[model samples]
Target: MRLYRMRLYRIALWVTVPMALPLLAAPAGLTAVRAARDTAPEGAPSVWRPGVTAQPVDAGRPFPALGAASMALRRMVPRPAIVSRAQWRADETKRDSHAHYAGGVRAVFIHHTDTPNGYDCADVPRTLRNLYTGQTRDRSWGDLGYNFLVDKCGTVYEGRAGGADRAVVGSHTLGFNQGTTGIAAIGTFGPGTPVPAAMEHAIAALAAWKLGLSGVDPTGKVRLTSTNGKSRYARGTSAEFDAISGHRDGFATNCPGEALIARLPAIRGLAAEIQGRYARAVPFPRLAATPGNTHRG
Candidate 1:
């Protein structure tokens, strides 16, 4: 019999069918299943949904997600309190996949630390240090994946090994790390958990600076390829995404959570404003047309 899977606007299938064949099944059943699987269209989400558009993914670097406007890869916003690896007192005992490098920044992904949010502002250093220890020692990542982290009081801590202004590739967003930066909001923000206003502004500032580096508008959207089939998107999928997006947009997790995700539009707008301010501060050279040449030189 033909099968179909249904999807809601913001929801996934309630159950996922196992792809592996059952060993206890009889030969006749196995043969029928194999024939059905082989007959399904390529890149189908599953045998049950042969016609639904399955999200694509890729194992290689994802394509750059950019907006309508293009700009030079110049740093525009000032680097905020980017705590270095040494500053975070990271434990270098863990091993991980080698660092990946990106040519320039294109987007900023928002995330949540999934940790407590009640620490004093002055204790941010310790919090960051602990985070580094956990990610490196427990998770076995070479470095903390987030490019920067924002605390409830609006304090921003630099993450990973590279300099804050550099296009440091991160492991934060599964399948879409290249050409993007990750900013983790240090708290589990669900119902009743108020996202801090200062933290939101800090995130906006960071997004403004990072996206501005690649001439991207925070309020715009860009295309990115998915490298991990396990993510919300399938491998080889080229999806257009907001320049400022939550981790959930790229992966199958509740990172950046509901509260932070709710504030993304405002954050994106504020980032655009910050970018505009920076652009105005540095005026571009006016090209004048010479008498002998029709082209402005």
Candidate 2:
């Protein structure tokens, strides 16, 4: 009987010791978790905070491969037809081809072709070819500088691949190339000249889609300047908003036209509303705004 009692006591001691060890380590483990949570930055997403939302817009129409929700939200401001494939091919060869882009897209840059007045009536393909092969080539650029081109009829044409509902990197500006997408309107918008309503709607829809895909907010206000090392709008703006911006913001040339530049604030406001409506339909966090007309990363 005495031997049996002693053996039971030993077994009890072993079990208790292991149980106590976990209790002892619990506090330390908790402390580490809290430290990690505290050090994590806001706006940036993490596993712990899955609720942290990016852009507020939906990525418009879905690519058949991506899914129904992956649709890109391209609304026709007007029914514009794609230029003939033959014309597009002819333009490609007649134009100077440069480096093809192979990077993910993050932002959109809008521009005006700066074509002379009355040239708007010229053949769209020929004009685009001249711009890509003639003008930009003369300046030593690759292909046409824009990823997408909008003609006077408000038709949007694919200038580069990876533009349809995917992140594509194309050459539009220096220093801002890595994560930027470029769009150019065929005609110039200046004082006394206005963009067509269809064009505006198309731009708004496309911008909303891009903003949603990039996780940026369409409604967030963006300041045009940067201070210190941080963007002033970064904290206040939504990441999901499209960085709807002009070419002059990055380069010296006025490519987006004076009239269009002046209309950006209104354009942004319209885009934000479109995105907000889309977000409400699907329910996502409103995107935060960033400083400057463009997104840095």
Q: Pick the candidate with the highest TM-score.
A: 1
**True lDDT of residue 205, candidate 2:** 57
Write model 2 residue lDDT over 97-171, tens digit each, in one string: 323232234556788877754654336666666665653445544345566776544556666533255444445
CA lDDT scores, all candidates in order: 0.65, 0.50
Query: lDDT tens digits, residues 1-297, model 1?
Result: 123333442234334544575544332322121111110012211123222221112222332334312324554777555545565565555423334445567788999999887866666677777777776666645567687887776766778755677776666887777678899998899866887777887888888878877778787778887666666777667899998999999887888888888888878777776676433322322222111111110
Q: After superposition, how far is residue 199 of candidate 1 from its true place, in Å?
A: 0.5
Q: Residue 25 CA error for candidate 2 (Å)? A: 26
- Lowest lDDT 10-residue stretch of candidate 2: 33-42
Candidate 1 segments exceeding 4 Å error: 1-75, 92-99, 277-297
Reference-based TM-score of each model: 0.67, 0.54
Estimate the TM-score for candidate 1. Answer: 0.67
